[model samples]
Target: MTNELELKQWYQLLFGKIDSALLELKDYDGNYYWDSVDPNSLRYFVSNIVGTPWQNHMGLSLLSVTDRKLSPQSIYNLMSTINARLKNLFAAAELSEMVEFNYSVVEKYLTGSLMPDHTDRQRQSFLTAYGSFIFNVSKWITTQFTNEQQSYFSKFLFPKLPFDNRDFSVRTKALDVAKETRKTETSAVTPQLPEIRAESHFRWNQVHRLRKAMRDVLEKARHDRITLPLEFSYDESEYTNERWHFVLWDKESFGRYYKVGTSSENEVFLEFVRAENLDDGRPGDGLWFLEILRLRLIGIWDQEYLEDNERLKIVEYLNQWGYEDAVQGQAPFQIRNPGLLTQSVFIVRNSRKFDKLLINLEPIYVACTFARFALDIITSSGARMNELLQISYDKNCCIVTVDNSVTPPSKNYIYRLIPKGREEEENYYMPEEVYRFMSDIVNLLKESYNSSSIPEVEYSAATRKHLMSKKRYIFQYKGRHINEFTINAIIRFLLHGTIIQTSEGNQVVLKAHLLRHAFATHAVQTEKIPIDIVKSLLHQKDISVTEYYSAPTHQQISDTVG
Candidate 1:
């Protein structure tokens, strides 16, 4: 048998340590006391009724209950016996009033065990968890009660009781108050700062010209063995053949012609033939400039330019020069060299200052271009990074299919890219911008890998085989597959200064998941796409999953009503 004072001390030891731990939890710490640093931020080490699996170790140290002296089993048995009696009383309650009364008794015992110095947050948490626990346990006890026993208990528990007033929602109300208090404190300490403006797309505008930039970097990489931060190294190319390198048109005559072909050497010249001479193989009079005007750029490409109007003006200039015009006299119109497009754009945007400064595009700049492309695809498509990475050069497309049959697990199938970890393959069509950039990357990879100008490797067959297999994955770094961690790192580096202030005025890192939400929300709420289609695009098994992603734009509650 245990003394009353000893029992009370034991209860204090258990609940006191728990309260202390709860108070110690810091929201801004690198690691939270009760939470894990994962997507869910799941509460660990502590919960409403018990602690984590490792609680026994904590209990032993706190209680100082050694096996040589006090029996831990005896204390556990005593608590279990008390709990059994409480369960009996719980099972006997039939009426809501009786249930609430029994719950109050349990609450008194639990609250009595808490230390007097408990923090407000810890107190509120305890109350909320206690209420929730009572509500759950009452449900279990209600199931076991006989009709007659329940009636007896209910009648006695509420024997001609006078009208009473007690708010069961007090715990919830206290939580709201606690949250407001915390928010006010946080906001006062860290007021909202000015928004950080994004870097100009001057570099992104050079994506088309990035091919030359990459080659320049590779050439520089050869001479100096300059170590780039991304640790992966490029293998030596086959030096016996001259396949790796391509000759560039002189900067002076860069825009003389445009060539499109499957291979670098054998390009099919898209000649401008007059409508009357369409069937003939002969080229029309120096009408090559007409083809330049007909080139339709993807919408995203134009965004790389600082201003839409400026890009539009450039397009207009190219199109404004047709020979069919009534103005017969032709003036000498200077053709801007494509090689100096970036410099030309800079000059035009800078009030035609006639600045002769040349922009040297580095290798890091080329790598960032790929990173931006990856970000674009993931954000626009609402596809998982893994799913997007599964897209092989030849198999890139986007098509969604729906199956209604119950057998074989019915689901909406997104066709085109084969899903990672699934055996099934489907046909789909991707957005044009994605297709174009991804195809360009494929060509770039082929050129880099098969280039004869690079020396052949002196590595083992296993290493060679591994490098060859890396071709299967779209995102490769120096013959190795670039994983999700590297992609996220690249994104973080690119968006270093970006920040978003919360209602509490706390600034948080802009995560990739935010971009995922941006895609879904834009599709469902902004673009007003059908909810079912949104679900299909997101690859969510249930419509409810998409609802979280498509929360409505915030507005005052009063404004929402008439």
Candidate 2:
């Protein structure tokens, strides 16, 4: 939770009109964008915190941008000399200016491709982690600093050069006011509203997008050999304007026709038909039916989902059992081996082969599978691990309970897990491995950790917020902060191990996320799965994130044209 006091720092910084100091992060139209410093200053700002040697590089780049020290070409050449070529890492002043010049351009520029959904439970968990106070302070400060005319507290809190040591009282008052102002500003901002319209649920400008979504659906329909109606009714009801219901008729099934409708506007075409249409006693229902239609039009559903879902079903079912062997040993992981968790996953997976199908090991398979499934759910769900662990297996379907830490600390986040492809499943669904992993975690936590005799510590909303704080570094490796250097090092190592050839003749080394990226990029490039499925797998709220990661690696892109 970002307290009023915490937000004051950046608020004071901006009020002071200082460029080189720290700034807080803020939500700009549902996304976070930091502003307030000059182009040169911004480089130093980011460099000091994000990268160590930013000043010299920026100074050199500054000379290059202006063509004073070297030709622009020479600057580019000089930049190329750097060993780790960072894309979108070094932002020039003009590019930053262009970001504000047009909002849509800014829309295209999202780091992490993450949207700040204040209302989203998972996002709230994250916001609490990153500290709303500092973020708000930073945003306000950036705005105040960037403008030609500085804001109210500039003269007092942040006096210009030739300052005296005796005037502490005046500066402190100004700082207090700045913090108050930020508290007002952040509290004033609201969450993004659901885009709903008569034509489609999205904004009007998304007509092209609707067409694309339809193209995917029609293709699926044709594949199932399921002919679709001329027009579908989505949210024909008075209250809900976004629910989409497609009047699809499968010629192959006994029901002969399934009016596939999705209450969820963002619902994929496959998920749309899968939900109610599952167990409708029709021959070849569910994903099997959807795939037949999809394949008929697009030629493939990749059957990746079938493997994943089969895994999910086993996991989810095992999660229902609430079982695990008593863990008598020490933690399977050591602080020295963070990647050990990743490696251990494969080891555990291969330990028991899937060959013993329809047997006692099925329960164990389900347990392990759901553990992995739970892990995937949190990653893709974008929720804190603890909040994700709070998912109630007691519920008919695993439903995640979200308790907000800051702002309205009393309110908990409530959301149902949504499954992909198979609409016949729960509202919110977990992948198979997550359920298995979570189940294992439950057993592991039970015997290993002392619950009743555990040392006392506050587990209130405040403490929860502290645990969830982004700065606290849950993903942090031992003796390593979750900063750029470590992240870059990991990516570099992963890249050195893998390589991809793009269509444009660029040979790019594959990074850690490259496989996940491949899952997304290959899906769209191949035109195999619908765009929605690709987005779901990638956990994108909008296509922009999809657009960034969805680009095929060199080889896949090259192979398409070849």
Candidate 3:
């Protein structure tokens, strides 16, 4: 019954008109205009152009289309308007028979083959709105409508769409490369051995010679214009050869050669040779070797074997690819061991524990004071580590609403981190304790620096570097602004002895999150705060996370029995 000619003509006409409209939206910069235009005119224009039941049926009439708009917001508003109309149409009618008809139009519009090319954000917005519409209408028709309607909705409307509804299950995969490496078996040719060996001194001396030889070999290869797969046979009489076999590769395949055992000699060879390739023969093997080389260089520098200028040159060369921390005194390659801090046990007890620690560690009063202040903020405000670091004093004590033009404005939290349009802010209300702490810190910083406006330091996205200001930080250690890593380290050090053994027989290391968990638990369980309130405080997306915190504790059970 459908006319192919008319369908083609209709698409052609709509495409031309929409393309013109999009052109009209171009601003002075040639970017799509985002200013408010007449939404009514736009809707009227679209409806008149489409010239079919598709307009009315999809609720093009109900669109609260704004006049002035930019790329994503413009597209989002249009889809939202269409979805609203679709909801009402599906709710009122028993269009069980028209499932295919409706879907064909939706699919065509969503594909936007005729529409002007738009940004990823615009595309995502359109897809999200369309996806939401399909899900909501399908559910309504199946549940509230007749049996025929349900069958049509379930069979045609739901299954035909090649996307998931919000109700579908999500599978998450945990892939930690480092953790997997620990469990992976070493090649038979390369046996794993303890890092520290009995012949560590002798091995280190051999390693130094090997390092120089490897560098010299690389330099010679560069001079000879030889590519990465360099070739040279080492004679058994190359050195004293006391440790193990002193030979290189066989000539035929030029295959990688190594000793069969897990001795210091093998380790040094493997560390140097394996740096060129992993066992599976992947590239980027040089990185591991480079790390080892840099560490050895640092050790040599630290032992004062190298002059200050020479040490500086070595550091600069190593840091050329951004391994500044590793080349420094910090052990960047150290594996993260799981902590033993538990939630309920630490929170109620840490306050007293921290107080005692402050007294004991009095020589470092600045670090201790900063820790205490940070602890108060985390416990009372429930801000995440990043959010806490980003917080700045505005000097405005009165509750104020934050209006973000790109997103919905919020009045939830007076003290909040306002990021750019791409991310959302979790506005939270500061409690009396947090407010007092802020006041005290602000006054202290003002008196110390003799300035009201304290400039906080944070990393810049453009250059990927930390930029600090001359003014003091609200939370600082040794006169430097405190970062998440520093704060976490401090928290661990403060609660080093505290341990919490879980029911699963695993130890939970006490971290800053333990304090957050404690705060959430106390707020939701003991204080009986609303889960929604808890979510806002914690800046969490769902009540489920807060529920985990509020789960009935062992103490609650014991008290109930008593």
lDDT of 2 at 506: 36
lDDT of 3 by residue, 242-310 (tens): 222121221121223222222222111111233222233343222212333323331123444556765
Model 3 ranges off by over 4 Å: 1-363, 396-414, 418-427, 443-453, 459-473, 476-480, 499-508, 553-562
Taken over the whole model, the C-alpha lDDT of each candidate is 0.38, 0.31, 0.40
TM-score winner: 1
Would you list the rank order by lDDT, best first? 3, 1, 2
lDDT of 2 by residue, 221-338 (tens): 6788655442443322233223343332222231223332223222112123312322242322211112212211111112333466554443343223221211221111112323
Against the true structure, candidate 3 reaches a TM-score of: 0.32
lDDT of 1 by residue, 1-562 (tens): 2253235433333444444433232223333222221111112212321343223322222122121122323233322333333333344432223325444544433343324333444434444433333333344224534565345323322212221213334355556776454333323212211121122123244333434544565456457875331111121112211112222222222223222112223211111113222334343222112222232221112445336665555455433432121122221121111221122232122222322222223333444555666666655567666555555443233333445566665433232554333435443334555556665566655665785222222211111121232225556635555545455545543443344444544444433455556566667655789989887777666788688666543421223563
For model 2, the local distance difference test gives: 0.31
Once model 2 is optimally superposed onto the true structure by TM-score, how far is the C-alpha of residue 192 displaced, in angstroms? 36
